[model samples]
Target: MLAVKLPSKETIKVVEEPIPIPAKGEVLIKMKASALCRSDLHRYHGKVLFDETEEEANITPGHEPCGVVEKLGEGVTKVKKGDRVAIYLGLGCGICPDCLRGDVMLCKDFQCIGFQKNGAHADYMTIPEENCLLLPEKMDFITGALSTDVGGTLYTACKRLNLNGTQTAVIIGCGPMGSGGILMAKGFGAKVIAIDLDNKRLELAKELGADYLINPKEEDVLVKIKGITHNTGCDGAIVTAGGSTPLNIALNAIKKRGSVALIAESNKAQIDPSNQFIRTLNTLMGCWYFNRSDWEEIANFIVNHNIQLNKISSDTFSISEAEKAFPLFDSGKTQKVVFTWD
Candidate 1:
């Protein structure tokens, strides 16, 4: 089997290794497609941290994955050989209190698949059977791979906001996750506005049903959003960029007492507490991985063609071309890039 391994910062090496065998209650999958995400870039640049105690040689870095089950270990009965599935990246210890509450991402022993363990950038990978979600018969590998991250993250953000039909929503950044938020908000019957510096991404947001698109570099984002909402401002804003600008924009654009759902990966930021307090902002929520219910909902929505995963996915690379995918994504020339084994 061949896998892309990050031996160190800014280094990716392709190496041949023996295919892994599934342990008890696990499944072995032959990967079909996996996506390169901005988070992967963070890991590549050494912006994202990993446990130093863990063996770095064992680390594999592609997490947004879809594959076919090749075998199942003992006690695994939910899926069988040949099942098409999307592997959940968060590998939570099932015995934790948080896991018991169905919030596996919050588990004390939580470890993400691509970050802490060997992931799907390989021809074959192994995962606990419970982490795999069965894909619909017609779901293609590319779409399924995107659902593992882009679609799932958007779903989780929307879930955090508890969006209802009457709310007005704005999404900052218009990358794959931000664009996904536009579709998710629209599906929930909210008036959606998308903000991005890139005209191409802003145009794509319009195609995905954003009622308005704001280019912050050209227009005053807060003013435009306020004007669109009849000066009331958006009921909620999802900040999908980690930079200080998008966070401030989201804070300024949201309605008083509204929520700000942040899905962007950030380490630190300069924030104004006074402004947040004056607005009586209900909360600033951080949404990362999806729960089991969120996974099921997103899968069903994609299967029914409600939220079009196929349209959001823009580029494809083979496993050998993984290096090129990151640069293309960083250039903002593509929306979502998937690497395939076939």
Candidate 2:
């Protein structure tokens, strides 16, 4: 088997290794699809996104992944061989209240799959049988891989912001996550306002489902959003960019009682809470990954709405081409870059 490795900053290598065997209560998966993400870039650049003390850099860097089960470990009964599933990124102590409730990311001992363990950037991987999310029969491997990270996160954000047919959602930073936000918001019937400095990304956002596009470099983003809402602020905004400016724009572009979901990973940011949040009573939430319990609903929502999750991921590479995949994704030249088996 071959897997992706980020030995150092901006470096990616594919190395040959023996296929892993499943442990008790786990399942071995034959990799089919895995998607790259911005967070993966953070790790590829030699940054630790989570607590992995034992040389975390060597772990295979892929969390958005899906595949068919090849072998079931002892005590595993939830999934069987040949089951198509998307692996959840969070691994927590099952006894914890948060873990039992399916919010594995919130557990005190939470461990991210790609950051803390060997994830699905390889031809095969192993995971707990319970971590497998069954996919709809019609969904493709690429879309299934995406549904775990980009799709689920953005859809959860849309719901957190209370987006609906009557609301306008301003998605800052038109990358893969924002692109997913466009599709998810559209699924909820919300009018989407796509904001980004890159015109190409903005164009792609529009092609996805954005009702309006605003390039912050060309004009004032808050001004355009307000104007689009007819002097009223948008109903809500979701910021996928880590920059302070976009986060600030998201704070100011929404109505007084409006909500904002920050999905980006940032160490710090500058903001005006007194007026933009405190006085305005804005609802700001830091959303990470979706709850495991929500997987079925999220998958069903995608199928029921006919949301094209694949549109967000514009490129795919085989395991051997991981060297090329990371650089393209890091350059912001592509949306979700993925690895596929077949």
Candidate 3:
């Protein structure tokens, strides 16, 4: 089997490794497609630390993945061989308080597939049965791969904000997660605003049904949003960008008593208490990994065609080309980049 490994920052190597054998209650998947996400870039640049030794030891790098079950280990009965599936990268201890309460992402023993364990940026990977979700018969691999992370993130954000038709929403970044947030907000019938520094991404948001697109470089985001909402401002805002500037923009654009969902990964961010208090920001929700409910809802949305995952995928790369894929993603030139074994 072949796998893409990160030996250190800005370095990727494709190495041949022995095929993995699934343990009890686990299954081996022959990967068809896997998306390279911003989180992967964070891991690559040594920004989001999973293990201090990850930088020194070679580790597989991927999470958003879709595949077909090639083999099943003892005690695995939920999915059979040849079943098309999407791997839920986050693995939680099922008996933990958080998992028992159905909030698996909050499990104290949480171990993510691509981060703490072996991931899908390879020809084959092994995952626990609880972490695999069967894909619809007609769903393609690319979209299925993305549903594991990006789609689930949007679902979590929407649920946290309690988005509805009467509310006005804004997504502070127009990357994959931000774009997914826009689509989800539109589905809820909320007036949606997509903000980004890149005009191209903003345009993509408009195509995805965003009512307003604001590039902070060209226009005052707060003023434009206020003008659009009749001086009321957005009812809810999701800060999907990790940087400080986008976070501040979200804070400024949100209406009083509005919710601000922070879905992006950042090492450090500063917020002024006065600004938060004056705006009456209702919540600052953290959306890192998805719970089982979030994954199921996202799966339903994809099956019902409420969200278009294919359109948001900007590029695809082969597993052997992992070295090239990381740099392209870092360059900010693509939206969703998938690495395929097929």
| Each prediction's TM-score versus the true structure | 0.94, 0.98, 0.94
lDDT of 3 by residue, 1-342 (tens): 889988767888899999999999999999999999877887788665555354434568788999999999999989999999998777787898888766776877777777788889999999999888888777788888877788877877887888888988989988888888887778767889888999999889999999988898999888898899999878888988887888887777777887888988787998876777554745677877577755666788777855787778898888998888899989997898888765
Off by over 4 Å in 1: 52-54, 278-281
State the lDDT at 50 in candidate 3. 55
The number of the candidate with the highest lDDT is 2
> How high is the CA lDDT of each candidate model?
0.83, 0.90, 0.83
Output the number of the TM-score-best candidate.
Answer: 2
Question: In model 3, which range of ten residues has the least summed lDDT?
Answer: 48-57
TM-score between model 3 and native: 0.94
Pairs clashing within candidate 1: none
Q: What's the residue-level lDDT of 305 in candidate 3? A: 53
lDDT of 2 by residue, 286-306 (tens): 999899999999999999999
lDDT of 1 at 70: 99
| CA-RMSD of model 3 | 1.9
Show the colliding residue pairs in model 2. Answer: none
Which 10 consecutive positions of candidate 2 have the poorest summed lDDT?
A: 48-57
Candidate with better TM-score, 2 vs 3: 2
